[model samples]
Target: MANFIKIIFFLIIVGGIGIYFLSQSPKIFQGSPQEKVSAPSQTFVSPAPTSYTSPSLSPAPQAISDYLIPSGFSRGQLSPYFEKINISASYAYSHFNPSEIKLSSNLSDNEKVNITGWQIKTNNGEIIIPQAINVYEPSGLFPQQDIVLSGNNYVNIYLSVNPINKNFRLNNCIGYLQNDYVFSPSLPQNCPTPSRSEISYLSGQCQSYILSLWGCKVPDKDSDSFYVSIGGSSEEEVECRAFLDTIDQNGCFRKHRFDSDFLSNEWRLWIREHILDSQHDRVLLFDKQGLLVDEYTY
Candidate 1:
């Protein structure tokens, strides 16, 4: 029994020594003084983009006044002024012979519009037009800027679209001008030609070789196919309006529909010259005042 008691005392003393030693030793699994616990790595994420907008896609500017201005007055300090106007986009149809577009407009309702100007917009966003403009009257090309009039009615105006662009696209628009003063035909009449850097696409003769660089063809002045887009009753028309409607929606020109006699060297040459550049998808039009008028995207 005495030996057993001695053994127990010995075990108790040894245990205390072991415990003290353990307390002084550095920890490994639970982080020692020199060791550190590594945290999980963090990931990075970018913020989403804000609203998308294009400066080039902004809408064109409009004239300030709704009424006709007197002749001799400048448009907001410019030589030729465009008055309040509206485009008859629906009734716009193609015209041939001289290669022009016959567009009807409601201009100077309270006053007759004698003088006018225009520009052409191509599918590639670049205007294929010259700076020179020729105002026309019922008699033909009017050289003098003279007018005798009563206003408030629809007038038919002509714009040359004979040569389609490389992309087979074109838009011609007449600008409506206005200013402040007693406007009258008696007021010294003259529409001086504006000087331009590039050749105006609108100045060329349809079949003449001098204007051949423009790649023009005789247009189908008789066809009313594009009318469906503006509310023409296709059901009552000669050609099926539904089929015509398809072509209009797609904006494609069918050779058969344009004119039955389209297979000519002139037509072929025009097509070859005015080949559309895929890189240029937008065409823009500006008035004499250097303001945006119209744009076409193909």
Candidate 2:
């Protein structure tokens, strides 16, 4: 009986140790349907870059031809000659002076004389005559033995020698006189001869006159008067036209006329009067006391 009990005790102890080991072992479960764990889905996307382009440019308009004058003529050198004469005399004549000579027959009353020589004496009492002529005129009567006259003499003379210069003073004088009346009809009664500056401005008119006395370019709008661009710029056409429209209520652009003739001394006086008035308006002021004041700023 003792041997059987001892064998039973050994069997029980072995069963107990097996139970302890089973409790301590890691437990692996049969994961409920083993849900397929897929790697985190990765999505790839591409972005577009922005594009840029330059804008096209337009060319400037060509200038008008009518407003343009020939530039080459502006710089040209024009030399106009008057008259030059060399005189030879065989007769033994005494007491010769430019004043004593009958220039009344040689020149018109309106004509002027500008004499320069070894024999001439100025009205200012200056002796411009050279020493060579002084020796010839020891008696003071025969001032110069050999004399050369050079100037614009208004009259026609039958010269021993036909004038050395064909372009004589007569032609120039006639041209000046004729055009003077045509271009500026409102000229003064004692109209001064046209100078280089006057001729330059009036030459275009003279040329037009030569074409036809009445050949003025008619305005596009059929007006008797028209606007003249003093600034000489076609680009400012819109601005210029607007300015003209503001000043001209009558539609025709006539110049503002003064009370006196344009060339008279009275005209200058009138200008002075208006100038003072304009300046007074610009600088004058009124005080609170209703008195006139000269100060520009309050």
Candidate 3:
């Protein structure tokens, strides 16, 4: 009985030690099958950090071109004189000076092309090329002619109000209008100088005064010094005044209207306001049939 009791005590001590070790181990747990699921591994998955983005505040780019070039129309080919016409790369596209676009014709072209009804398109707007008088007559009524582009000719299109009510061809006499109206690109003041034959009938003093006068200029009758410089009797002064009157545009037109070289190679066309962009622009030229003639970008 003593030996069996001692063996029983030894067995109880070994079982107590095993129970203490099991209690110290957290991973080794005594529980139901459902609880033994290892607590789903308790991995900290800090919900994928929410990402954010900001919106852009800038404006989108502006689209300049709207029309497609016709298939047959290519540079220097496939149309009547379209190839000979060109838009100058240089521009007066500013707010300070009058906005201007220049179109030129090749010097080698054999035939003249009428550009009336042609269209010039820009980023801001479009304009129809209008008819202008081929030769300007300072008459009460003026007729309109097609805007013709002869060989080595050019046109200056101004985006400003027309000084004259209608567009007209530049002439030697047109420079006289510079006194009354302002031309953006000033008119060519190349009027024919008066010869001695014009004043040979007058007295020496009167003849010298008349010959000394500039072409395309109206003597300043308003100035007191004008009469002093003329140094003539009232009757003679009347004759001088009459002669001076003939030096104006109307007078010049009357004198040189029949001359073959009277007309200039340039045309000045005025358009409505706000037709061009001041910062940058793409200019396009289309013929009467809306075929592309030329394009210029700046």
Candidate 4:
């Protein structure tokens, strides 16, 4: 019975020692308790991709940089003569002082256009183009004729009153009147020189005097010294004096009126008062029917 009791006591002691060693030793099933606890402390998460989109913009306005179009009209709605006959855009402003405006014709197909009743409407007011002599005659009654435009012709419109009491076409002889009257945009002084045939008829002293005189220039009739220098007592001197008298503008026109180039390329029209603004202005051209021809702005 004692041996059996001793055997039971030894078995109980061995089981207690095994239980104590297992509780005290480090764990090895998967990992240590500390390692298992620290694994979840740090975390990693990948970022998601993004999509792109484009922006929207508005369209720009349409405009013309050089000239202005009236509110009710489009460029295509204007007359067939729209750009064929046009206002002079060379000035910054079609100003009042020195007060001149110009109209030019640029017909491509060799057309003849009469601009007598055409209107130039400015910011100030409007003016009708009047008639003028086509070929001016110095001796006859002045007759106003329709101002016509042929190949490459231009008209100079003056804002002041007519100086000669009439408008007339300029000829080679027009320069003679310039001596007594002031013409705005002065008349050209391109009178024809004495013909070779005429010069051959004059005496040697008269020839020298004639050659010394300038074209479109009258001799100094008032200078007694000049008359005496030409030897007024002599026959040659008398003839030379007579010839000098004929060197005036009227004489020039009479001699060369039949020449092809006697007429000038420009026509001058006087409007009888100040017409355009000095600083800012808008000029519109209209046909006789009041249709828009062209426009200018400053």
The top-ranked prediction according to TM-score is: 4
Pairs clashing in candidate 2?
none
- Write down the TM-score of every candidate: 0.21, 0.14, 0.67, 0.69
Ranking of all predicted structures according to lDDT, beginning with the best and ending with the worst: 4, 3, 1, 2
Q: 14-59 in candidate 3: lDDT tens per residue?
A: 9999999988766665464656454455767678888552211011
Reference-based lDDT, each prediction = 0.30, 0.25, 0.71, 0.72
* Per-residue lDDT value at 88 in model 1: 27
lDDT (10s digit) by residue, model 1, range 1-298: 9999999999999999999878977642356556776889999888988976332222212243424332333334321223222222111222332112222223333433332344434452232332222221222232433222223322222233223211111111010010122211111211121223322332232112222212212222255333323244433333323322322211222212244432111100011122233344433334555544433334
Among all windows of 10 consecutive residues in model 4, the one with the lowest summed lDDT is 53-62
lDDT of 1 at 270: 15
Clashing pairs in 3: none
Ten-residue stretch with the least lDDT total in model 3 = 55-64
Model 4 regions lying over 4 Å from their true place = 1-72, 75-77, 89-97, 228-233
> Model 3: runs farther than 4 Å from truth?
1-78, 89-96, 107-109, 228-238
By the TM-score metric, which is better: model 3 or model 4?
4
The CA lDDT at 138 in model 3 is 73
lDDT string for model 2 (1-298, tens) is: 9999999999999999999888865443324356555699999887787754211100111221323212222211111111111111121122121111111112223432232221211122212211112111112232332222222222211112221112122211122222223311111223223234523433353323222312112222333233343235554444444433422112211221221322121100000011112112222222223222111211
Say which prediction, candidate 1 or candidate 4, comes out ahead on TM-score.
4
TM-score of model 1 vs. true structure: 0.21
